[model samples]
Target: MSLRGRVLGITLLLLVAALLSSNGLVIGQLRHDLVGQVDERIRGLATVAARLPSLPEVAVEDVPQVRATVEQQLIRDVHLAYLGPDGGVDRVVRAAAGRPPELPRLDAAAVAGRGGRPFRVPATGGGDGWRVVAVPRAGGDGSLVVAGSLGVVNRTVRQLTGRVLLIDSAVLALLGIAGWFAVRGGLRPLRRIEATAAAIAAGELSSRVPELAAPRTELGRLSAALNGMLDRIEAGDAARAASEERMRRFIADASHELRTPLFGIKGFTELYRMGGMPERADVDASMSRIEREAARLVELVEELLLLARLDEEGTAVPLHLTPMDLRTLAADALHDLRALDPQRPVTLTGPGGGPPGGAPVLGDEARLRQVTSNLVGNTVAHTPPGTRVRIGVGTEDGVAVLEVHDEGPGMT
Candidate 1:
């Protein structure tokens, strides 16, 4: 079943159980109280009958006087019986017209042994049966038996049961209606979350569940959690898109760089084949140009491969880390720069005049050397030939700092 149905079903089930329990208790109590009232009335009537001042003192043979005395003293629906000292039934009287089903007879021993406490006996009178109490006469030797019918008590309990069932039906109907609405309202937030998810699946990643009015409720917590997940997913998607764009740009740049050398080599080979280089010296110069372009292409390819490996796994580029002086690496880089272009004035300044054991750092020596060369090469490639370059190396704040400064027209 749906959540709303399940919730309503369970709620009604519990309500029904409670109503049934209450009805049972009500019916049981009604029966008990009514029966007790009947018993009390019977005992009171028996007390009055026994204490009658006009009752005749009669022998066992005087049945008419005994019957007359019982009829005069007893009320309707109350039957009276007298027992002798030996527990034999001496006379019986009915307050009403009919014989009233035979009242219980007491044995001789019981009549003689009767006490002030009243006792119950089953009645043979048919309709709803009867409850009889026998009380001993206060000033006499025999016992006075009084009996009342259970019909009134049974009828009252039955009527009460009917009314309880009716009330329960109405209560259950009202509760079922109210419970359905309550459950629907409770699950509305989940429906909103589902709609938001569907919108996101349809490419609206910005869609989000609306904030709940009550943040401390269970549904509110679920909404918050779902929104958090969507936020993360949207952020990840944006990052992935940016990474893909960067990859596209990197590929385009690499392709352009590769094309330059390839075009040079192809042009040189075509000229050689076309017999444009007639002399041996011209052919040798063209071959030398081809070799130079080929070496540049190979270096570019190696750099691209290294970058790819690094992208795949950061640790793919192995490094042997050891203590090395940044000053020495800087001085070597300056030497190489001057060899490539002697007129470019470059200076190195730091601790110990930028010599060995100046400004030590933990790094791979070869990688540090490559880094210095790349920085100096970038300066030479981008700046004018006469640019004054300063390569500085020092330790500050417990860190080695290498800086390359140039006096050429600086980049915008």
Candidate 2:
């Protein structure tokens, strides 16, 4: 069952138990008092009959005198009867207003044995029950059994029980309804938080629990803590994405730069094999170019390992920053390109596109060299071999600019 249902059910159960127990006790006490009043009246009538002026003052001497005294004193509705010592019964009179149930016939000897105490007599003729008391006649050996009706007590208790049942049922229903709404309102915030969690699971990591009123309240504090945690989670996710992007770019640049030196070495070897380096001067020049490309390749490989370690350990190392000319980097690319493909015409120029000029910048020399190498390598990889190339270096808008242009089929 739902919590609301259970709470209301338990409350109603306790209420019903309390009502039943309390009402039962009250009804029982009322019945006892009413019955006591009946017994008192019976005893008083017996006492008056025993001390009657017409009878012997020592003990009841005649049954007729005892019966007359009982009838006279029992002013209201009551049962008056005489029981003889020999088990003979003599019903003298009954209540005039109603047909009261008859009193049981017991041995007069037994009535005298009980010392005239009152007792209950269950109904035998199916009318109302009776509270009875038997007293011995002072004038004769008989019992004066007086009985009073229990109809009033039964009727009052039944009426009260019926009313209590109706009132308790209505109260239970009203409380159930009110409690349902209260519990639903209390759980509304948790439902919203559940929705936010589902949204995040569906890939909306930016989703957050809605804030509530009163930061000091439990629900409100929970929302604040959840939102704070989500913020950190989102930031960490974004940082991871950016890191992946940087790693991709670094791998691509390293691959291209590595190709630049390898392509130069391949060109030198192929030229010597095809007899293009016929003279010793030509072979010596080709070997020198091969050695320089091999050195640049080694530097690029070591830099790749260093960057990989830095990414893993989250540390930094100082760079070899120096005042270097962009022209020097561009001229070096032009040299390697010419060595790779001698037939291709490669030109070096300044900002005005006239001739090579100085473009000074304070930066790491190895990083700047790799940047120029990647530009030249991309040009060779995409465009056809022996394509015309232009390498430039100059300052534009107070910013150093290096441009590598090729005259071949443009990139598709």
Candidate 3:
């Protein structure tokens, strides 16, 4: 079921249970009090009839006189009966004469034994029922039994039940209506949040739930959390887009660089094949040129592969890490540079200049050496043949630092 339906159903169920419980209590109490009053009246009437002056003087054998006496003393809604010395009822007298109500046959012995306590008996006439009080006569030969009808009590309770049911139904309906509106009003913020989410899902990343009127409420907190999530998603998407653009540029640059070397090799090969290098010396020169371009192409391809691997697997590059001195690596790179370009004036300084002691770093030795060599080689490659180059290695900010400086024209 919808949330509103569930809320309304639960509310109505509780209300109905409470109303039923209270109504039952009220009706039960009312019935008890009314029946008690009827019982008291029945007992009182029995007492008065027993105490009548005419009842004590009457002879047991005189049935007509006994009936007449009981009829005279009877009050409204009360019935009086006489039991003979035997267990059977002898005569019955009512305040108003009609078809008399069906009453229990009383035993004279049982009536005398009871000591005037009232008891209940069902009427055979099938209506409300009766409250009976039996008392022994003064002479002890018989008993007087008094009964009162319960019709008034039953009628009053029925009327109360009808009224209570009607009021309860009306109240329940009003509460249901009020509760529905209250629940709907409470959930309005949630509905707004849902709409905002729908808009965001439709590619409107900037869409967000509006600031809540009640910021401290649960729905308000939920909206704030959702907006924070959207912000993160937007940031991640922008980063991804920028990364893709950078990759596209990098691929284009790599292709151009590779194409230049490949085109040189192709031209050299075509000149040799087209008989443009007929002399042995010309053929040797052509092969040498082709080898140089092939080497350049291979270097470019390796660099491209390294870049691709780094991008694909993040920083988890294969390395045989060992602690090695940065100074040793720098000295080695300077030596190699001097060998490759003998005319370039090279100098080693800092800790690597005088002794072996230098700042150490944990890394793959080959990769670290390659990196150092590349730095020094770049300096030599781009500078004038007579330029002076200095390779420095030391510790800075508790970290190993390597610096390559050359007295040459730098990149613009």
Candidate 4:
């Protein structure tokens, strides 16, 4: 089952258990109260009837008054009996023709004395189950007794119990429904988390749980944690792509730079081997070309080593980072660039803006020189003949800016 359904089901089960227990108590109390009321009323009516004159000795016309009083104050058709010394109903109110033999008999000795006495007996002249009470006359020796049939009281009790059970069941059903909705509402966040996780598993790296502001619940914390993890994963992936791109560019540039030098070396080595270098002049020319190619190859290897060092240690390496004169640096770089390609027109512009003489910037002198050399070498190798290259230094904001602008086909 879903978490919501399980939570709701467990809640409803507890509610039902509580409802049943409470209703059980109520039913017990109700039955006790009803039976008490019935017994109390029976006792009171028996006391009143026992005060009447002895039966058969009292006028028959006066019996209707006793019957009327009983029917008015208590239940109808209550059996009235006068028990003799033999303990049976000596003169029952009706003396019916077909009274059940198993019906209770009043004890004569218990009700005979001057003061009234009451006893409970089974039904007499009965159509249903019954209880009877006998009491003695207040001023005479003989007594009067009252009996009751319990059928109506029993029927009412049964109906009341049935109604209570029905109400309890109805309440439990309603509780179950309410619990289900409540659980669903509470677990909504978890469902969203589940979906987010599924999307991530499907390779949607950008997917994340929506951010929660100062979340207060466990599920909310879980969402925040998952989102944090996703952010780290995305960053790692982007870094991986960038590193791969740099590696590919490095390999391509290295191959291109080495190709010309390698071809020259091969041509010269083959010419020297084929006996074409038998003459001193041809031999000298071929060896010189071969030596130049070897030097170019060595230069390429050194550049590759410098690049690898930068990649490994970054610019954070401990190096001399003193303030340097920008004009001096630019002039020196320009002289080196012109010497390498004297035919190419190269110019060095003076410091644009500085406190005095030139802008002094903090950086490693050796590394900065390497940077200038790389730019000059790149321009010399790629730019057409007679292209103008301008190297300049200036202060932009608080930082020194170095510009190496060239006229021949600016970078691809």
What's model 2's TM-score? Answer: 0.70
Give the per-residue lDDT of model 4 (tens digit) for 1-412.
Answer: 8677777778878877887788778777876665565566656777766665554644333577665665665565455666655566566653322343244444556554423333334444545555555566566555566555566666777787789788878887887778777777777777777898899899898999975445777766877889999999999998899788778877876775665456556656665676757899977866775675577578677776666567645553346788886666676556545545556787666344232235688787755755665666677678898898878786667667676778887766
For candidate 1, the TM-score is 0.65
Across 1-412, the per-residue lDDT of candidate 2 in tens digits comes to: 9765687678778877887788778878987887777778777876765455333322222456655655565435666555677646654544324666555556766776778888877666576677777777777666666666677767877787788788878887887788778877877888899899999989899898988658999998999999999999999999999789878977986777698888889978988888888899989987987898899899889998788777657788449988888877887788778767778888887765886667889999898888888887778778887787888789878888889988788877
lDDT of 1 by residue, 75-192 (tens): 3465666666555666664442333544545654564455444454444544455666666666667767667666667777888888889989998999888888998998787788
Sort the candidates on lDDT, descending order.
2, 3, 1, 4
Most lDDT-accurate candidate: 2
Q: What alpha-carbon RMSD in Å does predicted model 1 have with respect to the real structure?
A: 10.8
lDDT (CA) per prediction: 0.69, 0.76, 0.71, 0.65
Q: Count the backbone clashes (under 3 Å) in each candidate.
A: 2, 7, 0, 0
Estimate TM-scores for all models. 0.65, 0.70, 0.63, 0.57
Error of 3 at 190 (Å): 2.7
Q: Per-residue CA lDDT of candidate 3, range 1-412, in tens?
A: 9987898899899999999999999999999998888777777666766665434333332545435544454434666676776757666544323334565555776776777887777766565677788887666667777777777788899999999999999999999999999999977877888898899889999898888766698776877888899999999999898789768966975765565455455656666666767899977865775675577667667866776667655664467889888877776666456545556788777633443336789987766655665566567568888888878788766788777788888988
Q: How accurate is candidate 4 locally (lDDT)?
A: 0.65
Candidate 3 segments exceeding 4 Å error: 56-76, 96-100, 112-117, 206-243, 308-412
List CA RMSD, all candidates. 10.8, 5.9, 10.9, 8.7
Candidate 1 residues lying further than 4 Å off, grouped into runs, are 53-76, 85-88, 95-105, 108-126, 302-412
